[model samples]
Target: MDNEKVRLQLYMARCGVASRRKCEEIISQGRVSVNGSVVIQPGTKVDDDDRVTMDGRLIKPTRKNIYIALHKPSKFLCSNEDPDGRSLAIDLISPVIKQRLFNVGRLDYLTSGLIFFTNDGDFAKKMTHPSSHVEKEYVVTTKKEIPEELMENFKKGIYVGGEFFKMKSYKLNGTNSVNIVLEEGKNRELRKVFQSQNINVKKVHRIRIGNVKLTGINSGHFRHLSEREIKSLLRDSSSKNGKYNNKGNRHNIK
Candidate 1:
C-alpha cells in the first residue's frame, strides 16, 4: 500500500506557519486554501501533487527535515515575529539551517533554557501532543525558600488561577533553588504555579526534556539531535498508568 497523504495542518507546521493546533485554527478561519479553494477541515489530506496556499500565497513543502536543540538565551521571544520588534528565537539559529524550522514549544522572554526547533512535522506533532506526556525538567531559582508545606502542597497538586497545577516531581536542590518536572507545557506554568504559592521566581532554566539533557550545551548555541536520540524520543511517547515506560524500563522524568 502507498503511504497515506500527510494531514494539511502537519504540512502547514512543516512550512513554519505555526503549531499544528494553530494551523487548525487558521484553517477553520478560512485563511488556508488548497487548489484554489479554502480548507476548514483539520483532517484534510494533501499529497505531493497538491498545491497549497496560505493567505493567497503558495506554500511549498520543505524537502529537508532539520532538528536542533537551542540553548535559548533570555530576552528572546520564542516566535517568528514580535510587534514590539524584539529579537526572535529564529535569529539565534545559523542561516544555513534556519530556513523552515520552528520552535516546538515556547519559552518565556525572561526564561532561558533548552528549546527544540525542527522542520519535521511528524516528529513535532508526536513530541508536542498532550497524550505523548513528555517530561520537561526545569531548574528554578526562587527569591524565597520553598517551604516544606508548600512542597507537600505541590505533591498534592495545588489549584491556581482556576486550574489545578501539579508537578510530576519536585525537590529543593539548594537553599533557594528547586528542580521540578511537569508533563504539561502550559504558558508560564512554572512561574504562575510558584506565584500562586507566594514564591518569587528569580530564574527558570529548562534542564531536560524526556531523556534528552542540556549537558555541555552552552547558552546561545544549538546542536542538531542525532538519529538515535530521535528514535529514543519516539519510543518513549506512550504513558501507562501515569508512568512512562521505555523498553520495559520505567522512567518518570515527568
Candidate 2:
C-alpha cells in the first residue's frame, strides 16, 4: 500500500493560502478545519481522500498549476488588500490566474523587482525555507558611494535591531550602486543594513530569484515561468546542502 499523508499546513500552502509557517499560524488560530472539524495541530496529516477547509471555505485540490514571474513595481503591496487603498501585487497578475496564488516571499513596498507567485505550496516551502538557502541577488543604489569597508562589513555581517544580518556576497557595481546576494530574507533587511552604515538606499531591485531572472519583463508585467526555469529552481533549492548550482548562466542578471 502506498500510504502517504502530507502535513496539513503543507497542503494549505500548496493551495496558495500562505507560507507553511503562516499556514501553521492560521491553523493554530482555528482557521483551518478538516472534514468540518477544526484542526489546531500543525502536523496533522491528510491523505488524498481527506477534505480540507480554511476559514469555513472548502479547499479544492488543484491539478492545473500556475507559476508567475512578476516584475513587481514599487508602491504595490504584496498583500491581498490594503486599508489605504494602495494597489497590491495581485492586482497586476493576469485575471486568468484566478486560482489562489500568493507571493513566495516578500519585496518591500518601495522596492522594484522580480517576485515569484505560484499555486504550488510545496514549491513555495522549498524555496523560502531557511535551510534551502536559495540565494536572492539584488541591485541596490545608495545615497552615497558604498565604501570598501562597508562591503566587507556586509560580508562579515552587521547588527541590526539586535539581530546580526549578513550578505552572502557583495560587490561594487558602480560608484553609487552595489550588487548583493543574500541567503536570508528578513523584513526590509537590505534597507536596514544600509541604514546601519549611515547610507540611505535610493533604489532597490531584485534581479534574480533562484535560477530565474527578471530579464525583459517590464515593471508591473508578469508571465508564467518556463518549464526549464521551474525545474532549475527546484534543482537549486534541492542543492541547499551542496554547492551552489546555476553559477555561470548568462541570464543571472545581478
RMSD of 2: 5.1
Model 2 ranges off by over 4 Å: 1-4, 242-254
Q: lDDT for model 2, please.
A: 0.83
Candidate 2 per-residue C-alpha lDDT over 1-254 given as tens digits, one digit per residue, 9 for 90 to 100: 03368898877776678778888999999988898899999999986678798988888556677899999999999987899999899889847677788888899999999999888877888888766678899999988988889778868877778877778897788889998988766898888888988999999999999788899999999989999998988887787634434443222111
Tell me each candidate's TM-score: 0.87, 0.88
What would you estimate as the lDDT of candidate 1?
Answer: 0.81
State each model's CA lDDT, in order: 0.81, 0.83
Q: Pick the candidate with the highest TM-score.
A: 2
Clashes of each: 0, 2
